[model samples]
Target: MRVGIADTTFSRVNMGAIAVDELRKHASVAIERVTVPGIKDLPVACKKLIEERRCDIVMALGMPGGKDKDKICAHEASTGLIQCQLMTNTHIIEVFVHEDEAKDDRELAWLMEQRTREHAVNAVKLVLHPKDLERQAGTGQRQGFEDAGPARR
Candidate 1:
């Protein structure tokens, strides 16, 4: 599977590198990293990666919570906080399937979606430091959670 991982910064690209390495162990995977300049940098980068790299999936990674105790205190800490940590370091947005290609195999789309979801969720849990994320955004109440979106793709 050719996957394009997008992040605003090189840090996310680095994480994409790690995810790619891991995916290689289980399936055929290729990755391209894109960097943009600014808070809204990810969208364009994501588009470019999808078009240029022709990735099967795209994932957006972000550090939504801040990295300071004060930052964490800002959020309404709760068990079911639906917060999306923006990928300050890096993020994957979507998995791209060309219309021509997707039409060839519908199952591939499902599989790609599963893999994309898994990659995003797992990468966040395994790659990001829980303490740092919690302290940064003060989502302490939302700690030790698993969003196992898929059964390991």
Candidate 2:
């Protein structure tokens, strides 16, 4: 299977590369990588990777800025990604880390690394062992963080 990695160049973090490395450790698959200018470009990159590069799955990685406009752009990018997925009938795993999601830069960086790596594994599972994920459904497993079990009164 071929896994495509589409990442934004707007941020300094190298989450996409980390993801690819982690994926290599877990699954033996060919990788196609593309770096775009910003989050908005991820959808097009992913589409090209799928339609032209023949990737079975595309992992879209980006870190949005800490601003309302940035959030809006992220939303638009996400919508476009969904459209691309439908058009190609392929899975586009979105791994977005907003600058404001964490309390500080250090925390955000950690989250980005964790999320990206986890999503890469997820992409592999989606292609090769979907049943494994299906069995974990409702188990409250957050890819980057510890699982939060159901609350009981």
Candidate 3:
């Protein structure tokens, strides 16, 4: 199966590289990469991969700036990704990291790698083994950080 990886040039770390690395661990899965200038462009890139390249699923990766306007754009981009998924009838795992998510560059890099890898796994399962994810439903699983779990009763 073909899995598309759509990342942005605005990212500080090479999230696409990490995702490709993690995805290569699995067998019989092909990866297609499309790098855009910013987050807002991801939806179209992902759609292209889905419709043109015939990807079974896609991972839309982006690093939005911490500014208010950037956050708004990220939300809009996320909505576009959702719409793209519905239109293509395929899964597009949206992996977005805000620039201010961590305190330092080192931590931020780690978070980006962690998040990308986690979502990479999700993308694989989404097509190859969706039942795997279904088994973990409602578990509060998180990417790039510790799992929150369900709020304590």
Error of 3 at 43 (Å): 0.6
* Candidate 2, position 36, lDDT: 91
Worst 10 residues of 2 by lDDT: 144-153
What's model 2's lDDT at 149?
A: 63
> Model 2 Cα RMSD, Å?
1.2
Q: Tell me the tens digit of each residue's lDDT in model 1 across 63-117.
A: 2222454234223221111121232233344332222323334444343444445
Instruction: Name the 10 consecutive residues with the lowest summed lDDT in model 1.
Output: 76-85
Candidate 3 lDDT over 34-146, as tens digits, reads 99999999999999999999999999999999999999999999999999999999999999999989999999999999999999988888778889999989889999899
lDDT of each: 0.42, 0.91, 0.92
lDDT score for candidate 3 against the true structure: 0.92
TM-score of each: 0.41, 0.96, 0.96
lDDT ranking, high to low: 3, 2, 1
lDDT of 3 at 72: 98
Q: Which residue pairs of candidate 2 clash? A: none
Q: Quick one: ranking by TM-score, best first?
A: 3, 2, 1
Alpha-carbon shift of residue 124 in model 1 (angstroms): 16
